[model samples]
Target: MTIQVFLPSQFTAPEIFPVIRDSFGTFSEIPTEVDFEFSNLRFVRPSGIVFLSNVARYLHRSGCRVTFSGMRRETNCIRFLDDSKFFEQHIGQAICEGSSPRSTTQPLREVRHEQSHNWLRSTLIPWLSISSQVPEHDLYNVQTCISEIFNNINDHSSQDVGSIFAQWYPNERRVIISVADFGQGIPNAVRTVEGELSDPLAITRAFDNEFSSKSTPRNRGVGLFDLKQNVVGRFGGRVTVHSLGGAVEFRNVDGSVNTSTYNVNGYCPGTLIDIELSTDRIEITNGERESFTWI
Candidate 1:
């Protein structure tokens, strides 16, 4: 199981609270009241310690024992009266095993904008190179989806200084691409620009039609919205966003939306987007039966 902590980075607490809660429920199934232990810890900012400590207190009151395997250094622990877990022990295995050594590199600013583009180009070109063997329609759609996600990170997540560290597990046909920064998360950014948006699900709604952070000269009105439309509506895939104290799941089959809010242990920043593409779908692309790459 994974324990995620969300704190204000660029986004405010209220805005991201619902997002975090939704995510927490999505990842876990409510079990009977008992002591539960988890090995994974994900923290965004140091301020998240307050929220986590509060969670520990609440869990104790509920007669549920919650023990975190590790703490995230990025989180603020000073606010907490007691240290809960070792920050590195649990996550070290997941990070080491899932990550690709070559994938770790310089920050986004160090590389030219085109460098990012080229990174994607390299990942996509090989697939396109074997276009003759694959269905052109599927290739077009998959490329579009990947481009939408990559462009979103470059445009919004990168900001002035940031980096994209992603690890793609070709075996499982799963890609975990994380665009992190000391910048504001999506929820907080939206709240600042749009006067009090009471909808705690604003971040989830952003994936729906017409929801965007851009105010002026909103042209095309595509990208993320289109990505959702194609991925869920067309391809049978799932989209998840872990930010604040909530998690939002966009299920593709029936266009169903699931949301929940739960208390996380610490303040964490930025966003980590994980996409699960079917092996059956990936095989239909390019020449091989099972092959995938990330830019």
Candidate 2:
């Protein structure tokens, strides 16, 4: 039997999570075809685009014939998604004929653990440098902040790959970035370390500096805490995380870091870290590259 999945009006998180759970959660391997209908999709965010790409990548690979339906009705959304390389990377063809000139975003990409650093240095940073006018040297801290996410995914995830996308909103002086993996969600990973806990509490506590899942008591979850601290506490940005059934948001208001959590509609398979960073508030480095020591 083929599953009829309706892409929502707003292709963003929280809203999309429920659809994901209902549509694909029960399958050990997707046993039927999927029609990812985009008929009503209007506005799409960075994470939302990656979610679409992620679904296409995972479902197609599972031998589930996926069809990206109903595009002509929403020309603008389809064009923007096409410019972001969503169709190209997923369906292996461009849905829209031409790219948008106002498309100030990187194409959605799936990067494995091994190629992450190079993708950061070669593609992401350079894009940011040109768009934000922050010298590549000055953006090292930004690079470091995102690298921590990669480390966390690499350490915690069963899959070596993760989907990533970023956008620069010139008028708002904001940069939105998202990375996610379809491995075990954050709450599931945390449950392995700390006994049984509610999904909301699991995600909230996962930000603690001392909390870890490793036998050696090293920090992948805490590294995320540091990422939150650096992004919000230092750079005055915001982070929203959706792992399984919980949603946690870290926002910087008037130089203060505020955190809030909520229960999502349904299970969001893995961990998605979505960041809204401010280009105006970011601190630039001295153009000297700083090497990291994992040990």
Candidate 3:
């Protein structure tokens, strides 16, 4: 039998997790076909777009005959998805026929480890410089934080592939970047060492400066901590991570670090990290720079 799924109008994390769980939960019996209805989708954040892409990629890889319908081409949301290469990469020509050809100039793209350094150095940094005029020094720190995130994926995620979606909103002077992986979720990985811990606590432990799943001497588990410092502390951006059935968010609002965590009804399969950076709030420092090291 075919399964029909309808997407919600606002597709952001935590709030959209139930929708995603319900949609993917229908595949328990291995339906012959899955039809995704996108008619009502009008707003999507970077995390939402990444979540959609992740679902589509998972369905495609599972040998399901998937079809997308009700996506109005005139809607800016559709245009954003199209420009992000979502349709091209996931639905391909089968459903995008007669639609505007996918634009090659979009900011969102999948990032692989081999190409990550160059993508950050050549593409991301230059774009941030031109679009936001972020100071070169601050950009370096941002690059370091991003590189550590990529390293965390490579070293800990066990999945070699991940998707990154980024967009710069000039009006808000903010940039949102989302990185996702479909490997073992963070809680499961951390459980390998921490014994039996709740998913929410495991996620919280992940931000600790000395927590590492690996037992090696060189593994300091400083990536997520340093990432929080750069993104939330320095840039005054927000970092949200959803893994397994727990979600954690770190934000700097009104000169205070606000952290909130709660449980979700379903698992995210792997991990999703969303970072929102506002250009006007970036803090430039004159402190000494440490040599970049991979974790």
List model 1 lDDT by residue over 1-295, tens digit each. Answer: 3334433333222333444455444223433232222223232322232223333333444445454433233333311112222122212222222222232111111122445556555644244324223454445555555555555555565343233333334455443333333335556656766665433365565566656676542424465666656555555666555454334556655554334433333333444344444434433544333232321
Q: For this target, which candidate reaches the highest lDDT against the unseen true structure?
A: 2
What overall lDDT goes with each candidate model? 0.41, 0.80, 0.75
Model 1 weakest 10-residue run by lDDT: 78-87
TM-score of 3: 0.87
Q: Write the per-residue lDDT of candidate 3 for residues 1-295, one digit (tens) a residue.
A: 7878888888665556777677666335556688878899888787877776776676777788888889898887887677667777775542333544322223456787778878888887777777777666668877877776777677666556678877788888888888887767788878988889888788878887867776672436457887887789877999888987888889997866678888876658678898888988866558445565655
In model 1, the runs with Cα more than 4 Å from the true position are: 1-114, 124-138, 154-178, 198-200, 217-219, 254-265, 282-295
Candidate 1 local Cα displacement, residue 61, angstroms: 40
The superposed Cα distance between candidate 2 and the true structure at residue 291, in angstroms, equals 7.3
Question: lDDT of model 3 at residue 97?
Answer: 37
Each candidate structure's TM-score, on Cα atoms with residue i matched to residue i, is 0.49, 0.92, 0.87
For candidate 1, report its TM-score.
Answer: 0.49
Record all residue pairs in model 3 with backbone atoms less than 3 Å apart, i.e. clashing: none
